[model samples]
Target: MDSVQVRPMQEDDLPSAERASAVTFFEAERSTRRVSDPEAEPRSAAASKQWIDRMRFYLSVDPAGCWIAVDEEAGANRAVGFAISQNRGRLWFLATYGVLPSHQGQGIGKRLLDAALAHADGRPGIFSSSVHPGATRRYRMADFSLHPQMRMVGTVDRSTLPVVDGLQEGQADDFAWMDQLDQDLRVAAHGPDHGYMLDILRLVVCRDGARPGYAYLDDRGRASLLAAAHPETAQKLLWEALASSQGPTLVNCITTPNEWAIDVGLAARLDIGQEGYIAVRGMPVPAPYLASGHFL
Candidate 1:
């Protein structure tokens, strides 16, 4: 094992962190496909950038909670592993934790995770989506229990949108209200920076008689994250998202016990892939909520 130091993530560390994440994801995907689906395609450049952007969003909002592992062997100063987390009140979300393939067995990833969680100060609640077996085990060792989770991917059916009273498409400026609604319904606080998703996603707002709700969908109409005052409102937003997607789309890292959300996905005929687990540290999140971004 190299003499690696885990330290607070700095502005200068973004590039290295991004690179390490890309490498780790690519390696993991390749390994998974080799064992489960040899015919699967490799990740595209656009996909890799999207992964980096997700991590960037977390780093942008919670730089202090993010940590990077620097290998200090023979004067080399570089990031071999990194862990990024978002501490939103009682909900501490672990966005990503990975070590370069060459450095995997050295405990660098565990060290980075420990430091990242330490920022939460033993907060009762923690959340993470674990795709790697090793990561799932480590999370369990940290006392996070596993829950059913999966990723759904498919081409959006543009014709699925149906007219629903009071459902309006919104723009980026409408994010403040949407974020407030999200915080109200979610198990944890989501910072105002959530509006960042609006820059790329199309926001669908549901105003069903004073109860306002919204869902974030890619330009083509696939739902990412959604929350509503009621299930009817959420279902309306989900349908609108299904109608808007223009091409291949996905809703990732959703907790499966949220039966309504899962049923919606099944009804829409989306293909479920890469089954994984959602690890929760404290009280588990009661579902029926939309899974959005990387942390969800």
Candidate 2:
């Protein structure tokens, strides 16, 4: 055991921080028996690349919001915990936070979080949080309101798939209107984040009549992010997402504000389960919207 110090995360710390995060989350889930295969490695190559890329993007955009805890013993200065956050206009979001199980309960997480919160600068803040008791306690002590989040996962019933219409492939040109929809719902436009998301996810959009909505789906047809002007439009976009899936689908980050998503998932015969929290400060849960865990 050694003294740990919390400091700004450097570009060089990405790999070690990524490992710390992955191991911490895996261990947390394993403790709850939520991990189906305990023998599987926590981070796959593709997932590591995605995480490192995101950390690089955050470091470039808001270096002040990224911090890492390092074991300061001689020859042991490795990252043991980390927190990454980002600010979009008046909104601040916690991108990721984790403390290695080996270093848990030593106040390293709190120190890292305090460092990260400094970047919020009094703006409204939000994050998708795992259902870890210690983490929940910390968020509550920081004055965040935790809204229980639900997730629907399973193979879609193809026979029940409806004829969803009005959705077309989205492009870079659609960013402006999509940003407006973002602002209308969450009080901030996901300006730069939209570009990042567009790089990796397929965007499906609906602009029919007065109902304008957009959803970003992964190759698996899981909705990573979605927002709309009306509940009906939101439901239509969700149904379209499910209908387009090639196999099992996931629709996560569903708060009480977005029951339309639950309806669509249920119609497709997806099973529902409680997962985490949409913790927020100074704002209500966004309705008719499903938030991105990384970008929220």
Best by lDDT: 2
Candidate 2 lDDT, 88-146, residue by residue in tens: 89899999998989888878788888888888889899999988888998999999999
What's the C-alpha lDDT at position 254 in model 2? 97
Name the top TM-score candidate. Answer: 2
Residue 27 error, candidate 1, Å: 1.0
C-alpha RMSD in Å of predicted model 2 compared with the true structure: 1.8
What's the lDDT for candidate 2?
A: 0.88
Show the lowest summed lDDT stretch of 10 residues, model 1.
Answer: 33-42
State the C-alpha lDDT per candidate.
0.71, 0.88
lDDT of 1 by residue, 159-266 (tens): 544566788877765666665665665556465446667667777787554677777777566777777777777767776776666677676556655556556666
Measured against the true structure, the TM-scores of the candidates, in listed sequence, are 0.85, 0.95
Model 2, which residues run further than 4 Å from truth? 34-41, 74-76
